[model samples]
Target chain A: MAILDPTTAPRRSQLNQRHVSSHALFKELGSNLVVSHYGDNDSIIEEHSQAQTLAICDLSTLPRIGFKGAGAPSWVEAQKLNLPAMANTTVLQGSGSLVAKLSDQEILVLSDIFAQSKDVFHLSEQAKIYHKNYDKQVYSLPRDDSHCWLAVSGTLASEMFSKICGVDLRTHKFSHSHIAQTSVAKTNAVVIRNDLGSTPVFYVLSDISGVEFLWDCLLDAMQEYGGYAVGVSALQRLTKEH
Target chain B: MKLLTCPLNGKRNISEFTYGGEYHAMPDHLTSSPRDWAEHVFFHDNVAGIVTEWWCHTASSFWFLAERNTITDEVIRTFKADEIYQQRVEFTAVASETQS
Candidate 1:
């Protein structure tokens, strides 16, 4: 008899069913089958080509969670989480993980660390402990299943975003570690500026159900700037080089 | 786009906030007449001068008070209500401690 590993099962993204036929290579990344590359070439060439151009990668499989309510601030503080004191700011903690204070009461934590390390999971588990201990005002807002995360980066990234976003997101106006909870592509989305390499990169978080529509809208905008879709492997390499 | 200064997320578009109506004192239901209660509930002076009003940021759900002029629609200032309330509570606590 063979032992079955449940964790090895390939999890799918919201756009998985729609994009499965389009991808040429699929890699299992932490229980998720993500596109390793789209065409014949390897992800390295794809990454190198995107050095001056734009590349949009789906990162919905990343471990992300939210904390909100009156006691959320204190709870986060108690946990000794590395978050900014002011709202609309982000802090990088434990490898490439980001902790964003969307507001005084609401927080969004994203684990961008390479290889989906145990360190990020440990940080997320601390929130569960806080929820168990302080169940009064602090509320758990798990976003893993609710949000579709995307990484849009490269030289013309800001230009592509300007087409859909209302706010000015140029590096001069919106620097690294800044967050904007505004309309993107006519939809409510949270945009965070966490650059990858020398290129400007942003993490866009929106409703999971609208992921396909948002992806199409973004790709349409990227078309004018010669942008294309890159796999998660290429994105990981870009972040590592930074 | 009209910009409203949020107490937390400073200077955001007015569309991002929801108007919470005028801020006024509630009539004492026990001592006041029905007419007074009705006036408190339905009537508004709609003054052209600067008046305090309630506003909430839709994204963050942060409720705050803004002083604005109805005529020019100019927002004079904006601040968190809890900040003022906390100060009052601290002052009262200090006063009681001094008296004791």
Candidate 2:
């Protein structure tokens, strides 16, 4: 008997074939595949274009995990995890990952660059240690499949968000590493202010099932701002620039 | 839209929190009768004056204690439940050590 390879299984993002343009280029990321670029391989045009307008990119493939229960804070502390002490705040860890303290008892861990790397697996294993030690007091909630993530960036990003969100997300008000759980386009979403590149960026996480609907709604809102979709290649380039 | 101050999340829209009703002491389950347990679980004083209650922020799932005036629907203060519980435990430990 042989173990099954999860990567070989058919896996697609919520946007999948529906959002891919005629000239889009696709690539595999872990078990799932997503659009690497809308058309250009270098993403130079996309990067330059986004400098003035807004760009929305799907990040559903990123690794995300949730820690909850009364003992979560202590458990995280015992693991020597560097997280913000206050709730609803996100801190960028030494590894370039994010540890968001949603509440005293709940936290969300996200990694953009090392989702498929051994570092992420190490973090997961460390979490398991606490889970085993505090069996009844802590619970782990894997969110890779439960939420659809989008990275919206550029100068006009805030303007585009204003159309869908009620909160004041201007840089002065929201600031860096601030997290808000509010309605976006009439759907509940968690908006985290973590800029990508030199431009302002927000990572929006919403229910996985409602991703397509939310994406369509966001695209419609982006149209007026002359916003367009960028693929993971462009997103990677932006991250590298910063 | 009304806002509620979550001790953890700061001031958030009231819609983000779920009212958990008035807080009351729970009778010791090992000693208390079934009627007492049921009363504690099913009944609330519904007081008009200042009262303490539990509230949960839906997004972060953070639960905290809120002191409010039912008559005015005004929140007086909010605090974390864990901090209060930890204080009580420490107090009990200190008292026990002194007695011993």
Error at A218, model 1, angstroms:
1.3
CA lDDT scores, all candidates in order: 0.76, 0.75
lDDT tens readout by residue for model 1, B7-28: 8777877888899988886655
DockQ, per model, reads 0.30, 0.33
In TM-score terms, candidate 1 sits at 0.81
Interface RMSD of each: 1.8, 2.0
What's the TM-score of each model vs. the native? 0.81, 0.83
- TM-score for chain A as predicted in candidate 2: 0.86
- Give per-residue CA lDDT, model 1, range A13-132, as digits (tens): 777655555643556656555666665555558655673479888878768788887787777667667779888999887666688998877888887635464534665688667657
**Highest lDDT model number:** 1
List TM-scores of chain B, every candidate. Answer: 0.75, 0.81
> Could you give the CAPRI-style class of model 1?
acceptable
Error of 2 at A24 (Å): 4.2
Pairs that collide in candidate 2 are none
